[model samples]
Target: MPGLLYLFTLCNLVIGTGAFVLGGVLAPMASALGVSVAAAGQAMTAYALSTAVLAPLVLVLTGRWPRARVLVVSMAVFALGNLICAMADSLPVLLAGRVLMGVGAVFTAVAAGIAVALVEPQRRGRALSLVFIGISMSYVIGLPLGAWLGFRHGWHVPVAVVAGTAALTCGALAMALPRTISAPGASFQGLGDLLRRAEVLWTLSLTLLYFVAIFCVFAYIGPVLQALLPMSTERMSVTLMLFGLSGVVGTVVGGWANDRFGPRRTLTVQLAVLAAMMLLVPLTRGNHALIVLVFVVWGIAGFGMMSPQQSRLAALAPAQAPILLSLNTSMLYIGTALGAAIGGPAALTVGFDRLAWVGVPFALAGWLTLRLGVTKGASWRPA
Candidate 1:
């Protein structure tokens, strides 16, 4: 189980690296492809859009296959997509490649499904936490490394690194997992049934709201920092690194809290704290040291939300955990896309001074919704 968990962690690292590379390489990619930086940034939108739309559909369509086989194939496809990005000479080609990466990255749901399937029920929260921590690790290791490679060589080099990693991860999964460990495949009707449940729908909505709040500020985090602190780019980079490191701790602590106190109480408290964090965003102005403290707290709240939400969904629909988890991932991406879209306008209008405050209602609303919709130990099996 430990070895298998490590493999899934690596798989998640690959997924995270691919998802984040666009942000780091947007400038170089735009320069190389002869497109505007904003145009190059559209590749991120394309990836998020495709991931949101395709993840569940692809799971249903391929649900019948052996899970390990599906994972291998997905990773292969992801590698292929990154390879395309590495060689792309035009914006359209890059967009197409990003779409492919989105399709392939849905395999992350497979990784989570495998984690839950292999672990004991009591330890499921811990297992899910390990799976999610990989994303934070990407920020800690993969994203920075890729960004550095892009700065040193070219944008293509960073993507090429991801392509290589995906290929290796695919190979590792094939060698590590046994053939007997797979769920029965799903039909479109199966997915439809899962979606019709009130709990599932509402739970997914909460997940969406959580990310929308975070990304609304996160999308404009750079300018927000600049407005408040007026620091050098190096200091800004270091601040972000510290935030990412704290997030790694948050993921672990979130899982432990869920296991100890139950998801409902843990998540409610976390969300409430998250709302408080947003409320503090406006206070960081001109206080560089204070801003650092605030960001650390923000990172803790930011990545901490995943474990409880994931544990909730897995508990609600164990049989459909893979499909449900895939949908959760989609909702998160949709929130990210919407948050970025909303952030642009909010930054322009309210300015970053109050931009952090803009996301406060979202966090509060999510907390309120969770309080109403999810009860302590209140999980319902899919009919």
Candidate 2:
């Protein structure tokens, strides 16, 4: 199970780097493409919107296919999309490529479903979080590397590298992922039916708000880090690495907390910490050492929320777990899209140094929605 889970982790690592490398490479991408920094950020918005809108359609169309087949094909599509992005000479071409990459979001959703399905119910939380560790690890490895390469050589270098790895991951997933395992896939009507439920709707709202809260800053983190976290060039390198390492630690601890304390309790604490950090991060400007501590804790709380949120939604509708997870992924991306879309312009008005303020309302709304609107148990309101 651990080995198989790590395979899924590697799969996510590639997919995640492809998705997140934009942040590190944003400046050069903007310079090369002849767009504003905010405009360049829309490439992320394009990718997120594509994932938010289309991955579900892919899920519905390929619902009955083998999970292994879906995983393989999705990585292939992801590789193709990034290759297009690397070759793009203009913004329209870039947008089209990102839209294609949107097809890749299914990989993560399906991976999560498989992770939970393969494990004992008691251990699903840990298994699920472990699957996402690759994404956190990307911040440690992929983002920094992508940024450095983009800065020195060209933005296309890192994007082309992402394409190569994704192609390799396709072969690895094809060989490693079991063809015999066929978990339930989501249908269009099945997804619509789940959305009609009040509790499910509210739970998905929680997901949307949670991500909007984080990505407001995260979407522009490279710039925001430069503005807000006052540190020397050497310390800045260490700070970003620490942020990634803490994410791995947070992911591990989040799973344990979910199993030990339940998703609701764990999320309450995580959300509160996340909200506090967003506000606190801006205030720690002059004190570099203190800022690093806050940023480390922030990464822990930020990445830690994923497992618990997925657990809550799964527990909400065990029978519809795949579809629900798919929907949650959509909301997550939608939130990410909203954050990027909002952050790009808002950063101008608020200043990157003070940008965490944008996420505060979202954090508060997510907590309120979770506590007040979502049901404690899996009781769905009648159709």
Candidate 3:
């Protein structure tokens, strides 16, 4: 079981790297595809949107399959998508490849769901959290490394590397897992039942807006940072690595705060901090120290919300945690889609330096909705 869990973790690392690598490599990808940076950025939106729609659908459809089969097949699709992307010569081709990757992106949610069912109930939470380590590590290693490689060798290099990794992960998962391991099939209808509750919708909105806030600036971070303070490729990679490191720190802080103060207060503070950091981006002009400081804090606050948001959903409807968690994942990707969709145009119009500011309204909107949710069912502390 432990070995299986580790495989899932490695699986997520491959998936997360593929999902986020574009953020760091967007500029080069744009040049390679002969599109503006913003257009190249839409590949992110395409990937996210495809995942948003396909994740739940794929999960439910494949619910009856062996976990190992599902994992291997989905990962194979992801690998194929990356290969398509690596060879893409036009924006449409890149977008098509991204959509294919999104189809395979369902692996994360399915893995999470099965992780819940497969583990002994007592250790489920710990096991689930363990699976998520790959996600943060993706940021720490994948994003920056892809950025560095893409910059040096052109965008295709990183995509090709990721494709290779995904292929390897597929084989590893197939070898590591039980042939007959199966969990209850999911129901998209069941997901709809959760959404019927007003509180669930409202709470889910917070997840959407929060991610919308995070990804808007994040999707274009490479260009945004470059516009502010130009740096060599090596320096940019280091800067991105620092940002990723800070996110890991923030995830820890979020867990601590949730334990002591509860998810609500922890998130409230995090959201406010994130919003302020977004606004602070433009003001960091001519100030290297300030930009560095803001990006670090922003990384902390932005990533910190994950722990609480999941906790908040669990607390909202205890019996519904599993599905709510899955649904929240859907909302998250949807938000990612929206953010990337919005960020590109906003970056073009508002200018890259002001890109962070575009996300400010989203953060505050989430903050206010969260506050309002408390009046109905959202609580300050988990009861």
TM-score of each candidate? 0.89, 0.95, 0.92
The candidate 3 region of ten consecutive residues with least summed lDDT is 120-129
- Give me the overall lDDT of model 3: 0.81
For candidate 1, which ten residues in a row score worst on lDDT? Answer: 374-383
Scored by lDDT, the top model is 2
Pick by lDDT: 1 or 2, better one: 2
TM-score result, candidate 2: 0.95
The TM-score-based order of candidates, best leading, equals 2, 3, 1
| lDDT (tens digit, per residue) of candidate 1 on 76-118 | 9889989998898898988899899989987888888878888
Q: What is the C-alpha RMSD of each candidate to the true structure, in Å?
A: 3.1, 2.5, 2.4
Report the C-alpha lDDT of model 2 over 1-383, residue by residue, as the tens digit: 55788998998989888998888667678989999888999998999999988998898789889888888898899999999999999999999999999987688988888877778777878998989989888888788777777777899999999999999989988888777774677666566667766777777898999899888888887778878655443455466677888898999899889889887788889889999988898897777777778878888988998898888778767767887888889999999999999999999999988888899999999999877654542573211
lDDT of 3 by residue, 21-52 (tens): 98998888888778899888888888988888
What stretches of model 3 exceed 4 Å from their correct place? 1-3, 118-127, 180-183, 315-322, 378-383
